[model samples]
Target chain A: MNINEIRNAARRNAGHVRRTPLLTSPFLDEIAGRQVYVKPECLQHTGSFKYRGAHNAISQLTTEQREFGVIAFSSGNHAQGIALAARQNQTPATIVMPSDAPQLKIDNTRALGAEVVLYDRESGDRDAIGAALAEERQLTLIKPFDNEAVIAGQGTIGLELANQAREEGIRNAQVLVPCGGGGLTAGVALALEHDAPDLTVHPVEPTGFDDVARSLHSDRIEANAQRTGSICDAIITPSPGQLTFPIMRRLCGAGIVVPDEDCLRAMAQAFTRLKLVIEPGGAIALAAALFHRHQIKGDAVIVVVSGGNVDAPVFTDALNRFA
Target chain B: MNINEIRNAARRNAGHVRRTPLLTSPFLDEIAGRQVYVKPECLQHTGSFKYRGAHNAISQLTTEQREFGVIAFSSGNHAQGIALAARQNQTPATIVMPSDAPQLKIDNTRALGAEVVLYDRESGDRDAIGAALAEERQLTLIKPFDNEAVIAGQGTIGLELANQAREEGIRNAQVLVPCGGGGLTAGVALALEHDAPDLTVHPVEPTGFDDVARSLHSDRIEANAQRTGSICDAIITPSPGQLTFPIMRRLCGAGIVVPDEDCLRAMAQAFTRLKLVIEPGGAIALAAALFHRHQIKGDAVIVVVSGGNVDAPVFTDALNRFA
Candidate 1:
């Protein structure tokens, strides 16, 4: 997608989405050895940046398409985002979720007035089930990240960051974004490329799920060997998206991978120092900024905290174990 | 302090202090039975609104006074605030803290380049020690909340809220502020009284320490029988400040008292829903908004989360126990 498409998406979701804050902490800055500004998308609706993409994609549907309703499949955050967005638009939504998804996410999706269909992650193909259901119901399928509209919606965060940096008189900045299927990273890179060319964007991923990092290095798509066991479940996609990898390969400077331990430490630090509840996946970029500070080149660094839909027990474990 | 002084303080603190975001959650709104907007001063420098007052007080010092340095006595947040503010102005700060203060607060204050003198809270008089140090060192004494400049600085939050609400097209709102010495409540009330007269401000206090509530009703200063206790140690002042009481009496509509359990619940809610790590004292106003919503009036309500400096163990307890 182009910068104009992203700008149009931003305008479309102006009042619908929250203008989340770009927060800073002296402690985090000291740890990172740079001025660190955190764009906490954990504070976004549905406790994730997925809301922006979901709202943007769903809001652009034709009258007839909207009347036919929408269906999507996700483990957590994306499901809640699409469910909430559909509910807001007075459209019926059917979300196909993994049976092992966090109970809170499932409950929240249902609470948002969506019909939830649960399938086994190991035994069932989520895509096949979702497609069959959508076909039967004549419902439009909303992809989590690969779609053009969704990418444009996620790019609004890049536009916001550029504007926020300008307001603070920061000309050049290094931005680290959490990469799953690479949609968010690619979208932000495209926006920054167009709006703030001086700013460099990098993708940060959990160690085992470093497909985007591998893809960027090899200049092609790459897949993870295993993904079912990572603590950062939210961004544990098996590989980078087809549509997203190209933009990221073309625009992003490099990729950074942080271990799970560092992600837990980052989550704890975010809670104690920044007073922000960041999930493990969301804290990957921050972890890279803090632990891999020597590798990043910038006076001002922006870390994107992507989501906070973690379970309570898991969060408690991270906080206590890391501490 | 009048609105003009507060306006000047806001101007002075424009770049020095963070313009913290006023966050909102639909779930919180559902709980509060109104549109609830949260002014999370926990995200402020030093993890509390105390930074605003301390910076305002210390920044206004003359060259001679600044060279002489400053002294203050606080159990927690204010100590860190003054320490950081003094260090920023190139002034040495001597903080007389109770020996029983949170270890994190003590470490943070010392890390910010301040001298810490710890005394027993139950036996030694903090005020006497602080006064003696200030006198002996020829240093100005920065009262935690009672000074005019400090009150003006805290009033900046009120100014910010009014401006933010206006930007959101909200004309009338109900503001709930946690009252310790009544400085924050009074300062915010004064600003709202001048800028948004239709907005009513109320003081929210822990159940046993509802001295401000009683004082307002009786038209006189009142004291909490028990001190050196309560999980909300950040705002466990024995009574309302002499300078702050009159303003609160004049402008604040009423007061709300919430139990400690409610505060813990609010803290957990803030963590889960708002992705905000709020201390028990900081969550008191939010508790009032959520649990005591029937007592408050207006279509829109503003809850000021005053601080987030709880010990890790304490926070974990709140999260696990409340959840």
Candidate 2:
């Protein structure tokens, strides 16, 4: 909600979350027709920025709360982030994931020492299951982004980015984020509002999953009509969260939606030029920065590549098609 | 030549170069059976560590020498590094590249504002050509590894690595470096000797092109029988440099040579686990750290991924086969 909360979250998340690099390349600059910087959160623990929020949320709990542990409903970056964050705090975690979710995500979450509760995607209500488990174990639910603590944690990235950008003499620019629930976007906007007001924040999403963007434009909460068909799956949430929507609507610029093709192309460019492995969902912000250059109004742009937990086949396909 | 030289190089390189992150992954640690930290120089400018040496060498040159210009004989990383460094310093650079070298490297060098003079790799004496060009233009030849300033530039990585290792509480570790003319290895070894003496340094090379290893073992420089056949071409110099070899001999531990298969596997691992794009040549140190775990000592191992400039086909093949 404020800079102080985000600053406190930074203190709690220190030594746990990685300070991902702000990567730059001349090739990317030429493509964008402007200076481009990438904050690669894919290099974060569990291969996403989700870890920052997860760790920060868990760190705020009381001693008894940590002992009883935490629970979450997800099967991707959020699942892994909670699993690692909980384990690191010596807290137990129960992740209620779809039975049909990718085996690798399930396995990786379990490997991170989480109690993985598999729910049938078609027949089971995951929220009910997670709620029941949390009640039984007295576990706190660490929402992916809606929770204040989580947003503050993700804002740590914004703090680091602001400081790093200033270090690079980037006094003013458009900061692009791959938005799903608008947690990162809101947190980044808040940090910039306090630290570097000259730099504006924009939420970029996949074409079909532009809920946050639509919500900002209409000055109201909006939901996506469809989410399953897009290749950019990581940031595919139903809509912006209750806590995150207000911040995003107040401080953010119009959202930039990029096609899956552009995300794939951005992935390939990141692979070959910057030597970074960015997943399609994670690469969407970069895609907008590169392909939607006409829409951006600045001499410089900074993009937060959200995550890199893509499957081998999908990654190979991206390279094969665009590299 | 010493820690002071490396310290000075870091000072000169402050704003001009990128201080690449020391990346770590749980998956990598699981594979190596130790706390593995990767110094991803692949993320450096020009997609390699050669930029450090190039910038350092250029910075130390007299104004007259810089105005007169500089030259180098390389078709890959060095050419690009020199080209970018020269451009940043407003110094004219002429890169004498082999005609058979990759077209991408040549074009990239030229794009960075370097004069590209291609010589026949099979017939034309590249040495003679480079010498002639340097003589006619009154250019200072920045040797790839043999020069003192260049080696000191590479040593800056060692200083950073030592500091990062301590930050992670890794006091004792084996630092594996992908060895070519031993510039990086020697630089890192010298830095570790002064800063983190408990961290032993090792030169990791491809099996057949183990010239530095052989030279170290025999107490004399030993040339590789063949260099053109190795996929690890970025680190396939004939032998260790005269300046670098002595430092490596005194400060480095026994060499660890891994197979080409291991290098490819390491590249895939880096891609999938660490979200890093590493070339086979650059992945050699990681390969040695992962596959040759038994040969290493201590509970921690640090590897410097030297570069990431592999062609797409080669990268795709690596992902297809090992990812």
RMSD of each: 1.3, 1.7
lDDT of 2 at B208: 91
lDDT of 1 by residue, A1-323 (tens): 78999999999899889888778878888999989999999989889999999999999999998898999888888898999899889899999988888887888889888999999877888889988999898999998888999899899999999888888777678899998898789889999998899889999988888999899999888999984777787788889898998899889988898888999899888887888888888999999999899879979898999998777777788778875
How does residue A191 of candidate 1 score in lDDT?
92
| lDDT per residue (tens digit) for residues B1-323 in model 1 | 58899998988888888888778877888888989999999989889999998998888999999999999888889899999999899999999988888898898999889999999988998888887888899989988878898899899999988888887777678899988987788889889998889888989988899899999999999999988667888788889998999898888888888888999999989988888889889999999999998898888888899999877787788878876
| Top TM-score hit | 1
TM-score of each: 0.98, 0.97
In model 1, pairs of residues that clash are none
**What is residue B242's positional error in candidate 1, in angstroms?**
1.6
Off by over 4 Å in 2: A99-103, A118-124, B99-103, B120-124
Cα deviation of B69, candidate 2, in Å: 2.0
lDDT of each: 0.88, 0.88
